[model samples]
Target: MIHAYRFYIDGEWVEPCVPKTLEVIDPSTEQPAGTIALGSAADVERAVTAARRAFAFFSRTSKAERIDLLKRIVAILKRRNDELGDIISREMGAPLAMARAEQAGIGATHFEQTIKALETFAFDYMQGSTRILREPIGTIGMITPWNWPINQIACKVAPALATGCTMVLKPSEIAPFNAVIFAEIMDEAGVPKGVFNLVQGDGLTVGVELAGHPDVDMVSFTGSTRAGIAVAQAAAPTVKRVHQELGGKSPNIILRSADFSAAVTAGVRRCFGNSGQTCTAPTRMLVPVERMEQASSIAASEAAVLVVGPPSDPRTDLGPVASSAQFDKIQTLIERGIAEGAELIAGGLGRPPHLDAGYYVRPTVFARVTNQMTIAREEIFGPVLSIIGYQSEDEAIAIANDTPYGLAAYIQGDPEEARALAGRLRAGSVRLNSAAWDSAAPFGGYKQSGNGREYGKFGLHEFTEVKGIVGFLND
Candidate 1:
């Protein structure tokens, strides 16, 4: 069903209001992967109406039922895992291995995490002779980004379902087929009709309509800060709750107490992972002024070894940015880094010499960068790292918290001291000594990175409305 160019609305594959389609480009080859039926305002209205109609019954479901439903979803995801990975690789240009394991695999992880959260969650309890209820916030409008496409979709979709909230999803048009397959999975998992809907279109049409619609109770968006702001403004008139996880230029602080080689290597590796498309990537690395040269050398070495090839290459460590627009933006930033006098220790302009075509970017390292530099300030969503020098711990902390984005930050130092320093940083998530990612932990931003958390139990809460029955509940 998903193979066709159709929207999954009201639990059926339906044709668009007007038969318009958009081509999905595979960045690795700059070739057409496929096309999706582009939706309009009318489609958003149809999807939202369906979601609103279903919310009443779905919200009343027991937690156990939702847990079972999430379990089924997880099982189907795992069964079709590699298949979905192939789709992601084709559309987004992630190396097949990373695409399979991290990209497609993360979807199952989100569902498993949602099931765990749903199992232990307390939907209602009595306090002071009053019953406090956490009810579903009906009809959610979710707009997700192309980078880490499934990660955004599952994190939002799983939680909304776990909380019994119906939703209309506007996945990034750049890599939309994964969402089509995802909707198919929901159908196979026996998810009720109208409980979840998928609309294929750009942000201007489907996204804006969903956000501004009177029936949609909340808007959840994951994308650039500029786009996130637009979603908020559009949702304002309806007074719908808006949850956004926007852009980030997350800092990775390599403290004086740590091993310079080890810290710098790890920072570069993390930054370059996913071809540096991660929003929470350590784009800016802050090191002591004395160790700048060492950090620069280590970072350059890491960048040198990274294989920037076609996503089809098994040995490829980094793949192309999602589109030509992304390639141009990253190229401009690399040029700016050189022009601004930041020492370009590794990678400058253009694609790798070996690769004749494709949007592959040279893994770049810019040293002697100051916080004021555009390379340091901007969220260049590519495998580019900027090494900024800091004189003292206070300066490092200051520099780390200086960005408008507070999505995540990293500290490579003693666990205890990093813990202390982590608190001082204004980011929502701070990893210590390259700590592992915790799915249960609350994940969101402190400021303009956007509002609300979306992970485990924290994510489930975001889809709920709190109500108190004071007089009716007499204990």
Candidate 2:
């Protein structure tokens, strides 16, 4: 078993002020995979102090210097890519193939993209007679979720480094091995001492302390909506900037012009991808009422083919959810879907056949679901899909936008009509005809989904504060 009992602070691996530890479980086997030291407020303070001290020089670093640092980090990450994939699979139940292709790959992608963005990004620009400057915000406190662990970490960390900002990261304790490995990568890449720090702990202690720390200029959080509100509240006293990418119950609208078979199949695959734990998953499928039966059949057929097994299995497409708590939550929601009168069209309640142990949940689908139903309204972080029929195109848009979340929306139909309909979506990211996700595009949400954005130029800008210098140049 792997043992990670030290926190990364000030360029060294040091024991926490308090020696509390948490067992890291492999969700697939329900076995203890590893252990990590649980951090305390004192640990958070140490990390914040280190970041504050580093900001003095790091913030003033030239773009070229920061670029080199990012490049080096990317190189080290590439060398350890496969190792990262295996570690993440064991920690969070992501299939090994997915862990390598997306989990680990996205981390490297962020660093590489940020480096290219920095090459042409203008930090200082002129407007009228005044010069506008975008400077790095100091001492960021980042709290990332267990789902998409490395992806969230890299998106935040890569941009912070690119923008020449110092940060203290508190990766989710449930899935922290990848973060620990990443910190080692930073050390190997020769990141300036104290420029980056890691504290492993739960949100109540370390996360709260990091957000409420007076020295932290900003707090970037990616997790559930409830925790995000708490982070915002804690950081409010210090008036630090809070950037959140919270929960999403995104909608997928299949227009009357679309091919139902293809759309429904693709939607099921996308929804179940990551065991349906993605914050922006298209969980609620809005189909034409006239074709409800047809859509349901396709969705059921598509879900039937998914291979649910241990993450280590080469053929497994769906692994167990991240933890016992998550598994329980998904199971409860699936039961609620049934009790609430939604028709069970596919797999339902309990583990897949032959899976006696582990946190596995059956990939479930509910048909004839209404917007008011619990299954359709709430975010079920599992392989569950709720298909709701809509009377008209206008009704579909209304139903899609009814939720508190506006993280993402999907549309399938003729290109022209889909594009036109996509304009009506309240979501931040709208995918048409199952288009490929663009890493360069700004990603976040509208309304309760959370504020601010990440990825590419938008991500780099999130770590910076704008300053307008009036009359600095002679006119």
Task: Identify the leading candidate in terms of TM-score.
Answer: 2
Candidates' RMSD to native: 1.3, 0.8
Which residues of candidate 1, in runs, are more than 4 Å off?
1-3, 472-475
TM-score of predicted model 2? Answer: 0.99
Q: Supply every candidate's count of residue pairs whose N, Cα or C atoms clash at under 3 angstroms.
A: 0, 0
Error of 1 at 330 (Å): 0.5
Report the C-alpha displacement of residue 449, candidate 1, in angstroms.
Answer: 0.5
Give the RMSD in angstroms, all C-alphas superposed, for model 2. 0.8
Backbone clash tally (model 1): 0
Give each model a TM-score.
Answer: 0.98, 0.99
Candidate topping lDDT: 2
TM-score for predicted model 1 compared with the true structure: 0.98
Tens-digit lDDT string for candidate 2 (187-209): 99999999999999999999999
Model 2, position 112, has a per-residue lDDT of 88
